[model samples]
Target: MNSLENFSKWLQEEGRSSGTIKTYLQIESFQKWWVAEKIADRFEPEEVTVLDLQDYKQFLVQHARNKRGGRLAAATVNKLLQVIRTYFKFLIETGVISYNPALKIKNQKIQKSHNTVRWLEDKEKIRLLRKINNPEGMKNTWHYKRNKAMVYTFLMGGLRVSELAGLIIPDLGLAKRRLTVHNGKGGKERDIPINDDLFQALSEWMEIRKESPDEIVFLSQKKGKFTLQGIEHVISKLGEQLGLEDFTPHVLRHTFCHDLIIKGYALQVVAELAGHEDLNTTRIYTMPGERETKKAVNSLSMGDSF
Candidate 1:
């Protein structure tokens, strides 16, 4: 019926997940911004021009501020541009526009550094695992168990947060000592082995978890499925308690990959386990991180010689 409605249908037919569709539809904000800028009385896809897109890209780079009033990351800007480009493509396919105006715009370059991939150091991992493993004085035993299993799944299994949230009862193949990620990134499916530690943690949670008809692997005390934010909140609270700054699902995932690389696991093996489509993504772990760099520098320290 409407442009957005048609776009939604198109995205669904393209097999994009609901989350991805929602993200792509965030182009409404850009449309509103365009109208507010007095570029046109009303935002229309067919009327948009490449110069308008360039101006908008410049605005995003120079003016866009996140919720915290900080400049948006290059990746965030590029994601927005991607949404715009896709929406324009949709318009062209539907015969609403003659051409995709946003096509030629290039994404901002993202500099990769060793520090970019944040993972837990040995001591930090030990501290976090120790506390979660044997949480002393924690009153809510149910929450502790569920949260511990979540932490272990991230740390040991290398699952993305979305995959963890999407996990169902059938996905946990305890008999085979592995967990199936049925809905991994890009709808790919993979199985991660359930080592003794992860198996024990998951089993402990399963014993006390509330029964839900949805068969969700993890459930809230209210018998509802955990949302992405809900899962992050649980982990965030744990991070606060442990004094681990920026402790997140991705950090745990990085730690898993990094640890595997450090242990001499093949890049292909780590990529498959982590569901990474690219070996280059896995190879970043092979680079010397801050700890290794510090160790090398400290070895030549004048104070150490004295």
Candidate 2:
């Protein structure tokens, strides 16, 4: 078999998802084309050269087409390059190659625009909560309560959807006003403080949650664990009812950060509370909009004012 087959087996052994493996295989197809068209038959792994990589880079830039019949995006090409580089590194480590040819390949720089954080305004938040509490909503009474609790947890604790979904009965410490998040992103565990609002919501939810301690904290109508898709669906439905645009769970997280920033909490403190390993990741949420910027500028004046 070829190197791609061997690398696919290695990725599987390393517990990579099938989707990831398939992406890698697609990248490998590009490399195989380079081998067939440019490199001679004797060009084995050890015999691969930097010139071969340069030729491959030219091919990618000039002729690479995605499945959509358009030129491959810079991001996709970059990912493909990363996969090849990783494969070359593995080959070097395993003594299959003396030098890593893929190391010298320079990826195209793709300019990324800053994403404005979508957060609920104070008025919008109040309106949403009021709508949830209204008794006249057509149906899905249990869903309203469950989703209210979900949004409350997100707003109060800044919990990621995955982290919230992974929560169990033991994770919640009502007495101490804390919850232990297990294996969050990058397998990091941290303690999140629970406020009175979240605690009260939890208390209310617990009356129903007591039926299954082994199950997730959030349950479906069938009393099973709440899937991520289910949580998203609830958010979408609520957004439609409230006439709000893009009201995902992540917006609740942004609201948590925005409220804290407005309350004059330090960025470092917010970052810790948000379970962000990098402070820069938390900084994105704290970015002020044009209105705040104009207000700040208006607050300043020349010292020579009569």
TM-score on alpha carbons, each prediction:
0.85, 0.69
User: Whole-model lDDT for model 1 versus the true structure?
Assistant: 0.88
List of clashing residue pairs for candidate 1: none
How far does residue 188 in candidate 2 sit from its true spot (Å)? 2.8
RMSD of 2: 5.3
* Native-to-model Cα distance after best TM-score fit, residue 215 in candidate 1, in Å: 1.6
Candidate lDDT values, in order: 0.88, 0.77
| Model 2 lDDT tens row, 49-145 | 7787777766777798878888877777777787778788768876788878787889877654334567887778898878766658547656656
Give the CA lDDT, 0 to 100, for residue 296 in model 2.
Answer: 91
How high a TM-score does candidate 2 get?
A: 0.69
- Writing each residue's lDDT as its tens digit, candidate 1 over 1-306 gives 877888889988877778788999899988998898765788877777888899999999999999999998988998899999889989888888888888899998877788888899999999998998886798999888899999999999999989999899899999899899987765678989999999999999888874547689888667788888888888888899989999888999999999999999999999999999779789899998798899998898698566
Clashing pairs in 2: none
